[model samples]
Target: MGHTTGGPDSAKRRLRRELLAVRNALPADDLREAAAALARHALDLPELAGASTVAAYVSVGGEPGTLALLEALRARGVRVLLPALLPDDDLDWGAYEGEGSLARVRHGGRMALFEPSGERLGPDAVTDADVVLLPGLAVDARGMRLGRGGGSYDRVLARLARSGSRASLVVLLYDGEVVERVPEEPHDAPVHAVVTPSGVRRFS
Candidate 1:
């Protein structure tokens, strides 16, 4: 099992590099504005309008910001659950109380992540959510999400399926991140919808 340098893995890695470079180059003001717009559009989704619990993640570095949406969901009385990366790359869940409730955590040499400072509800907690907000680098016209290759979210999706959870799987990205196609693998799953700064696109 040596390192792979071809096929879907290579294709996905190349695309991720290209996308991350663009995201990392964005001005702070533009990122902030995009975050605000993303919040507005995501809040309007019918799937979220009546949701009582949502599984979401905090953005870090070049990722699309989710703090505004997380706050808005909390304000609307939705119980928002955030992920804390587990040692095996599985995610444990915790509630998002507010801005002050997050703790900065660095896993190995990776970027510091903003995670919940409250009680951990275990990985299966995500199955209880009515909606699951996924973080991705890009998504294609067919709803295939291009993830960062961490496999954490892939486990989450599998867990949801095993639990028979009907949570709407959604990804947030910039409008340009929605492209014509993305490299897909057998384990990759299509999302229900994607919320960009400009609008929301539904796949199923």
Candidate 2:
């Protein structure tokens, strides 16, 4: 008998299992209330309020609320850019004008909403952005994030680092998803802060 080798698929299964367990454990009503509070706090933050352009992720799976926050940001005249998954597995950002510009992209067993536009931005775009909200399965108090086994955000954040920009990395999560630690790899990028349904927490 031979032991099964744990490769990419195995890692993905582990991540999927963890996320599923966390989602199942989340308190539905409390999470919703916390999401509303977090949205209010994010909107009122000086960084978010003053930002001319912001990059935010399109949440998938059972992640907590973000639609309301995105709408609120748009209403405040902030230029919102969303990540569009490209064929090469890199992200191409596009302007999010409103609900009118949204189109469907199939992903993760269902369709994901995306904004498709020819406009593309580089790492300097991060320097220009005052705030950027990152998507994650789990985030720790020290700012380390555990993503869905994909290296997309890590690659993008690395580009920002090479450009010497200090854009805020805000990870949106459900309240309990904020934990003491998460399994991390060498290439993983750290977040600056975390936003839960309750409020925003700054991590060192």
Clashes, model 1: 0
Best by lDDT: 1
User: How many clashing pairs per prediction, in order?
Assistant: 0, 2
**Residue 122, model 1, lDDT:** 96
Residue by residue across 36-63, what tens digits does model 2's lDDT show? 8878877866779678888886555467
lDDT of 2 at 107: 60
Could you tell me the TM-score of candidate 1? 0.97
Best by TM-score: 1
Clashing pairs in 1: none
**Model 2: CA > 4 A from native:** 1-16, 24-34, 107-113, 117-127
lDDT of 1 by residue, 1-204 (tens): 878579998899899999999999999999999999999999999999989999999999978899999999999999999999999999999999999999999999989999999999999999999999999999998999999999999999999999999999999999999999999999888999999999999996
What TM-score goes with each of the models? 0.97, 0.82
